[model samples]
Target: MKILGFRGNVDPASYTLSDALPNFGRASGDRSHAHSGSTAKGRDGADVPIAPLVTIAIPTFNRAELVEKCVRSAMAQTYPKLEILVSDNASTDGTVEMLRAIDDDRLRILTSEENIGAIGNFNKCIDEARGDYFVLAADDNYYRPDFVSKCVRLIEDEPGLPIVIAAYDVLVVDEFSKDDRRTVPARLSKKLSTGIWQGTDILQEYLHGRISAQLLSSLVRTDILRRNGGYSPHPCASDEATWIPLLMEGRAGFVDEPCATYMVLRESLTEGFTADKRLGDLREVLDELSAVTAKKVSDPAMRERIQQLLNRYLAYMAAVNLVIYRRGGASLSQAVQKLWGWRTVLAKCSVTDFLSTWRLRSIVRILSPQPLARWMAKNGFDQWV
Candidate 1:
């Protein structure tokens, strides 16, 4: 239970829960670089309160060491009013003991009697959260100390904004070698500038791969998240299902600074996914998004725009699946079957739509045989194609 970025070594046994929350007074190293106060300037240059309670819900299973780091990061935040909710999904790996060792009043621990799936654990976290703002923090990922403070500031600056997303760094951890780690700039970090963006614009950016669907990167309004029904039950891509609808409902603010770390573990869920499974899960996600859009959006033109964006996204996903299948050494027939399965769902898509949605490279990939595509990929020509 070693905490990172605390001023000094703290013995958990010496403190009671009441005094565990740190006093983050005006410290020079704080990223916000400003003291908490009642008044701040809105995006429109009007005055607004800067104080709000933020709850970070961390749903974890079977990753004790990583979960401790995640909890330590949350406990080290500079924000004065914050709570860290750690929902354990019946982990047998001593995760509960590790959590109990920490003496923090701001932390609320909830453990399920049996192993609920990841989505169920997430929903439990959401149901238990009691803060003005909510964020879903993954067990393997951690945040910067100023992450909460900075996001709160942005939301306060824009009174009506439902969400605030910040730039983040990617931390790649090797599975075999625990010591091996690398940090890289997350995708679209360069493209994201500090400002308030329209909800539709944010959705468009997300569809274009200019933004990530990680809930850890965004602080959302609690009521809005509850209203949207938290995360979806899809086997995969549920985060997209939860986030897209919320983004469509209200505007979001962006912060340029990298305020969190998204950890990519070799044995993590994303890395273990197979091409077929990924595509199948994505199909579910797409269907859910379409239904949500049609029911929420009344304007026919706007609905059409969203549909077009989703269609393009589906095409892009198909291209990714082709690459994965080829790289994984699947047979030509197997790859074609997977491609055809996806194609059948998108049967109404025209050549013009496909070409426009993914550009010529996707068309080339989709049309080429598996062996040829693999050769092209091996020779590095597939990158440009």
Candidate 2:
């Protein structure tokens, strides 16, 4: 048995609770940074404390090498007050051994006796996190060194600030490479316009499906996450469930540059529509959105519109995939059967969603020859995805 303690990064003198909190019996801290008590303006015009402790929780499993890179990037953050918690979900590989070799005082590895499942591990990271602010980072993704410092300054605590949007690079790579090396050209991923991206009206954009999971990597408030029930089994929109309320009720932040690199395996990116779980995911997403909308949104009109958008988005996605799949090889009978299944879901969708240029181009690509489709995608088609 081995023990990796938490007595390294946290400084006791700088630690304080707002009103009340459940004590996690953390080890005493000794660190270089101390709170100066300087306050900064939040998005809501209220003053917020600066230099608070930020936790970078990397919930990882057997991807030892990828997680090692993630840990190193986390350690390289320019933020002065930071703690890196790597939760090892009973990995059989050299992940624990690899984590043990890291010498940073900020790095603390929490080992589970048995696999707690991914979502369970995610919530566990939040439950065990000791920072005032938190980031539930993906184990395979690596961040820019200034990822923390930049996002930290933009944080405004109106309460429950779920995510700070940052422009990130998407590195499509081969999953089976001896090296988890880059496979395709890297491109920047964007959600909305930069500068003060969150406010009262942001909820509509969120419900409209503009804030997809690709933008999930960002700084978050610790207590807000726990109060929102952390992560749930939305399997479809797990990130959205935790982040939407806070994003809607509170505020949001966005950095115009790359804070981290989101690594997507080339196979996942290039695979056929039916080959992936997207249709099922989209259906599940609709179910999840209905529940979230009913609970978080107040206005009846707004909730109705949200349902329409959700239905439309689902219809567009399913329709696009169906068209592509049918053209690619699936028989007419199969396509009709799939369409029959989606009929109820599509009935609620607006025709405008189906007529959008984004959808049209996708359909044209699949209908075109392989070479032409590839050329159109690379040349002028809105590969904004």
Top model number, TM-score = 1
lDDT of 2 at 343: 65
* Alpha-carbon local distance difference test for all models: 0.64, 0.58
Minimum summed lDDT over a 10-residue window in model 2 is located at 1-10
Candidate 2 residue spans exceeding 4 A from truth? 1-48, 156-162, 175-193, 197-215, 267-281, 294-308, 319-337, 368-385
Reference-based lDDT, residue 45, model 1: 58
Candidate 2 residues 110-184, lDDT tens each? 988977666667767777787777787778778889888777766533322456655455554443354544322
Off by over 4 Å in 1: 1-50, 175-184, 189-192, 269-274, 298-300, 356-385
How many clashes would you count in candidate 2? 0
RMSD (CA, Å), each prediction? 11.0, 10.0
TM-score of each: 0.75, 0.73
Instruction: Give one digit per residue, the lDDT tens place, for model 1 in 1-385.
Output: 1111100001100110000112112111111212245765544354534676788889888889999999999999998888788988799999999999999999888888976666667777777777767888778678899998888777766764678877566564562356656555554534557777776776776676565435667888776787776666655455566666766665677776677876655334123356566656667777778888888777788788888878777666666556445445566577678877776666645666557655455445556775675465334464464
lDDT of 1: 0.64
